[model samples]
Target: MTIAEAPPRLAAAADASLRWYPGGPYDLARTLGPLLRGNSDPSFSVQGGVIWNAFTTAEGPATVRFNPAGGAGLEPWVDVQAWGPGAGAAIESVPRLLGAQDDWHGFDEPAFHATLPRMVREARRRSLALRLPSSGRVVDQLLPIILEQKVTVIEARRAYRYLLHRYGSPAPQAGSLAPAGLVLAPTAAQWLQVPSWEWHRAGVGPQRSATVMRALRSAVALERLAGLPALEAATKMQAIPGIGIWTAAEVVQRTHGCPDSISVGDYHLAAYVGAALTGQRTDDAGMLRLLAPWQGHRQRVVRMIQSSGFRKPTFGPRMTIQDHRRH
Candidate 1:
């Protein structure tokens, strides 16, 4: 999707601020929620009503601060600040990051109005404010997903946190403007330098580590995918050895605000979605069939159903625990 026009320049460039308005009702917390791994995630954080992210740009590492200046509805303009060598590029992408660039496209097709469940329809009307955020940082988003491949959520999260704390640097040139303890994920070169033993220690197996190395080797090319269409970006991500449909969909969902990409292989998504929509668990194929009517807006439908309080029954484990060490 095309980016919204460049945000208006702030009066002062102390931290390189850019003022921007959303194309629709924009909810700051909801838009940003999916990008953050968890509260303790090192690469992204929310503190003191300010959202902080440290990212890798072609120029260098940059620290971004999103400060929302109040107004009602779409008038709430966001003032974004950036620091470090890549500050200019980082400042320029703030609107895209918050999904201001996302367009609903054919979601409003007249024939599709009643296609969604009544609960979700109500949610859609109330949640026009919900947006799909795009960080535009490919590798930073990829590594953690690599860690998650075929593993439990606890395992992936722990490994990611370990790697970030061990290899990530404090946001460069951020000085006092950045929150205390804010950290950036490792740069592409730094990722390649992580020792085999360290990967083992982080709970990443040989196959997953190999995938990480492959992705880093093609870092420049992979980073360019951020500029491509979300569908095309997801397709290109599969060219990497360890990336697959599931990983690609998850990555592009955040990096490109891909509305149609589905987490087809996510172990629990099918069941969760199936139960939410039909009150009975179903497999991935069933889930896809159910979502087919809204071809271009499947993820949006999923998000609406998810936010509507319908949940998969508690008859089974919330998440699968597949031990990868046996591999």
Candidate 2:
């Protein structure tokens, strides 16, 4: 049968299900995994082949469950169901949010392929289904990312968990999809109301908290960035004092699925990319030089490198994981 005429595939056994045929290759895990900040992230959960992602949309809180149909292979289809007052909008956002809308045309061009190492090329071939998912919610992405700035991942995760448990609302259909206490992100106003003491208790320091407060003050303006170009959105985000290149890149990667927004100021990324591409570890300038050729698709190159499982040599002292909650 022609692509458009393919038979409908069932994703879930439930009654309120919606099926989506991507037609092209799609890997649900590779595309959506980055959005999951941590395994313990209360906003996202995966169990029994189902991905439960909860978020606050313009309408209200939504919990979207994704079930991949067929098997683990190219061109897999997905079954989606959303619950909450914003179910319709959330369901409609499934395709964009899951990277079904991502295009991979120029990535495999002869010139581009010639530049990739054998390992990276093989990874690209194996992961053709990898697409960047755009959640279309800047705040949802921004909050967690802010907490991650200049902190150990464990510390950031603990702070995120604490904050969500304290202020986050119950996700729609939490009983069915998420862990018992799973919750959606706090509303914009709620973010503003987060007191100084609570910030300290959550292990979030003044700088990051101040950044969040600034973003929340202009939450409406920031949310409108979903409609702007990725470059433009990142620029606007950087206008805030604490939100710099690294933070902006993190936000746009999920908010716009921006292919070119590489984290220029990331602590480990420059060294990792430099070591992976060249033989030696390099600074941000060297990494940028190496990645300059893939200007429009720099982030794509980074993702390919990441998927290739290449690791840089580690010889320095690792960042200590501290718990500010005890103090």
Q: Write the per-residue lDDT of candidate 2 for residues 269-325, one digit (tens) a residue.
A: 888887777768888899989888878888988987786677889947788876665
| TM-score for predicted model 1 compared with the true structure | 0.90
* Consecutive 10-residue window with the lowest summed lDDT within model 2: 1-10
Q: Which stretches of candidate 2 lie over 4 Å from their true place?
A: 1-17, 72-75, 174-178, 322-327
Given candidate 2, what's the lDDT at residue 89?
76
Query: What value does the lDDT take at residue 299 in candidate 1?
Result: 91
TM-score for each model: 0.90, 0.91
lDDT of each: 0.80, 0.80
Instruction: Write down the worst ten-residue block by lDDT for model 1.
Output: 1-10
What TM-score quantifies how close candidate 2 is to the native fold?
0.91
Q: Best candidate per lDDT, number?
A: 2
